[model samples]
Each structure stands twice: as structure tokens, then as C-alpha cells.
Target: MHQETRLLIGQISDTHIRPKGQRYHGVADSNRMLAQAIAHLQGLDRRPDLVLLTGDLVDKGHPDEYAMARELLAELAIPCLVVPGNHDHRDAFRAAFADHAWLPAAGPLHFCVDTHPVRIVALDSTVPGAHHGAIDEAGLDWLHTTLAADRAKPTLVVLHHPPFASGIPYMDGYALRAPERLAQVIGAFDNVERVLCGHVHRLMLRRWAGTVVCSCPSTTTEIALRLQPDARPASFMAPPACMLHLWSAADGMVSHLSTIGDFEGPFDFA
Candidate 1:
């Protein structure tokens, strides 16, 4: 029998940090929001074992923006794993986060991290020079081989683009290409606990191919929720948030959203 193990993971996505002193649009400051979120993560009763930054680390993928991001992220006490989003430049991202040896020097950034309770497989869904996401044959083969390598451990797949189409029309247009292929790959593994994604800039949860797919909202601005046919493309400064994925053998993996901000708390439960 697999001994019950508990692991807590923190995920913050779409940081979209601009150069120092620059704001994301004229309003939202990615750095400030990220700092607050980090403070909140650290303040949790139990700290996470690892923090995953699911892409879009910078607004323009510029060196200066990456420098600012690196500096802000340095406050984290746990191991931080990163993947590239559509807004990211592969070379710039790799260079900026060079300490992460798991990142390939110059290719699709797909790798797996073996941690206590789950095997985290981060897939590179960003296609070069494109906004939409795709996992080519090679990426799929890599995923299959990686998952098959060890079947006992529970798995968590992370990517920038979600495989399922969200009701938000504009974002849906850029949804992951050929999702059926991803489905097939995920379906092959019964131990996969969840697929965590970011990019839509909203918090959403759905089940795709028997696995839960959850998209984390951005730490900057959020895409306006317009599910109607006539809805126009717009973004709103909705409450910035991140997710905490907790795992244990008995309860499996459960995800919770931690909205960034100071809130009144804990009076005695008596």
C-alpha cells in the first residue's frame, strides 16, 4: 500500500510584470500584486513545498521586466518552478531564470519534477511566435514516456494554455490546438490528479478527459467574463488570485484559490 503523504503546492500565473515602475496597463502593478501574493503564501499556517509560476512571467518578455520578476520572486522560501506563456520569449525567460537547471537551454521547455506526493510534469504549450498553444508530436511522445516511467506516484500536469475551451470567446479562439491529442495522452494515465493551467486570466474549473483542469487567475488584470455571443473583448481588474493544490493519499488532490489582499480574520471558533 502507498503510504499517505501530504504536500502543498502554490501556483501563481500570468504575472505580466513590466519593467520597474511600469504598470500593466496604466492601473495594475504586477510587482505589487505578486509581492502581496507571496506575502500571503508565506503567512499561511503551513507553507507550500514548491511554488509554480505558470508562465507569462513578464508583460513584454523584456530583459528588464524579467529582472524585476526575478528579484520579486526571490522572496519565495520554497522551490519555484516556471514554464513559458505565449507572452514569453523563450531565450529571455531561460536566461533570466537560469538557476532552474530543469529548463532546457534552447528548445521546448518541458520537464518533470519529482516531489513528495506528486510528480509535477510541466508542459510547454507555447508555440514559437504564436499566441495559441500546441503540443507537437515530439512533446506528446515526451509526455507519454515521462508518465509511463513511474505509475505509482500521483501526477499533476501544468501548462500555460488550458486544453478545454472556456466560454470566453476571445480567449477560446486561442485555446490549446488539437486538444484531443492531449486528452488521449492524459487518458492513458490513471494516476494523473489534475491539470493546472493559466493564460485565460480567469479562475475556471472543468473536467477534461477524466482529469480536473483548473485555470488560475492572473496576479495582474483579469479577462472580463463575457460568455455571451455579443460580448466584447475586455479586461477587468478583478481580485488577483493564485491557487493552492494540496495532496494526500486519502483525499487525493484538492485545489483552493487564495485571493491576494489583507482580510479581517480568525476570531475564536468557540
Candidate 2:
């Protein structure tokens, strides 16, 4: 695959679907909001080859919520890959997206390694009843062993939480606990091209452990891009967004942020 290649992927995250088809985090019109996102993806000129539901597939680990989310994702023509989030119950997520084998042993994590030109290692970093994050020693070892096998492969490490701070005070507390260990593993691997995650409920791009890392905004709601903490949590905005990641064997990676509505922003740079 070259940079000009058309292997595009769509990314949706932090949906937080409610059991009664209720709004998530108090964001109104949850189903409509999600539907809007799907419509957006469908309208893309070059439809994505695949779609990744990067975590927070539901609000609670309830069966009904999973059912709702499952049906929602099934509407997409492409494969929708999922992993568990802190709010997601592993069993429910697996039961919902049952076709994708979660892990070798019974665990809440989903670690999928894409072995194409770019290797994507998806790790399940959810901890039940806990907001903070960490990949256990076993997960770390798995990452290490996987990375060790391929020295020249370009890799993308996808997970639920940001391994570092996004500077949002409230969300910062939930930052990956014991991130240094994870950093060490990342440090050891030179083949890592980037890392993608989706817990902040906002769009962000920054560097971590010498790799490009970013979070795609929610398909339903978004956390405000606050440089400083705000008393009231920021919520819904128009043009619910997802990301289009273009990875290639020759050109590395390029990205585009996809929106649900029209745009007029090629304005004069006056």
C-alpha cells in the first residue's frame, strides 16, 4: 500500500449508548446523534474500507445497551471493530460483538494486531468500576513480545485511554495509571508509527513516547477542548465527527476529520 492507496478507515469513539436509548452524559438525541454520524460516514466520496468503534460502546455493561449498539453498528457496510472501555462490561461487549474473539484467556481486554504494512496493536485497557487506566504486566509482556517480532513493521498502538495527560483536569485523573511501564514498552519499540485512542471525547493530536498520538471526537457528544478546567462539563455540538485514517506501505500515515454536516470553511485567509 502506498500513500496514494485507498485503504481508508473510519473511526468512531465514546458513543456511551444508554439502556433506554437515552442520551449519553446528558447529551440529547442520542440515537439521532449516532444516526447522524453513520449518515456522515456513508456520504463520504470514498467510503472507508473498515470502521473502528474505538471503545465506550455503551454507558453501562447491560445487555440491552449492547444490543442497541450492536444494531447501530451493523448498519454500516464495513466491519466495525470494538474494544472494551471502563464503562463497558467485558462480557457484554464480547457478547454483543461476539464474532470478534476478544482474547485467549477470559479477560476484559481486546488486543488485535493488524499485520499489514502497518501493524495495529489494539489493547483492552478497561478496569471495572475504575476510571483510571493501566495495561497489566501480562498485557505489557504481550505488547513487548509482539513488538519484538517485527523490527521494521510500522505499528499503530490503539487503546481506550490516553497514555499521557491531555491537560483536561477532570479527565487527567483518569489518565493511564502506571503509564511509565507502558512508555518503557513503547520506548523499546522503534517500529511504532502512531497510537490512536478515544476516551477524552474530544479531538486531540500530540506526541507521546516519540510517537504521534491522537483521540477522535465522539460520534454523539464531545468534551470541550478546554485548555484549563471548567466548572461545567462541555457537551454537544453540531457536526458530530469521526476520523479517516489513511495508512500506506510507502507514505506512512495521513488523516482527515470527517464531519456529519456541510462545510464552508475554505474562507479567505485575510
The 10-residue segment with the lowest total lDDT in model 2: 108-117
- Candidate models: Cα lDDT each: 0.90, 0.77
Which tens-of-lDDT digit does each residue in 32-66 have in candidate 2? 66666787888788888777777887887799988
Please give the lDDT score at residue 137 for candidate 1: 98
**Mind giving the per-residue lDDT tens digits that candidate 1 earns over 79-108?**
889989999988898899788888877789
The C-alpha local distance difference test score for the whole of candidate 2 amounts to 0.77
Model 1: CA > 4 A from native = 1-4
Q: Positional deviation of 249 in candidate 2, in angstroms?
A: 2.6
> Could you tell me which 10 consecutive residues in candidate 1 have the lowest summed lDDT?
261-270
- Measured against the true structure, the TM-scores of the candidates, in listed sequence, are 0.96, 0.89
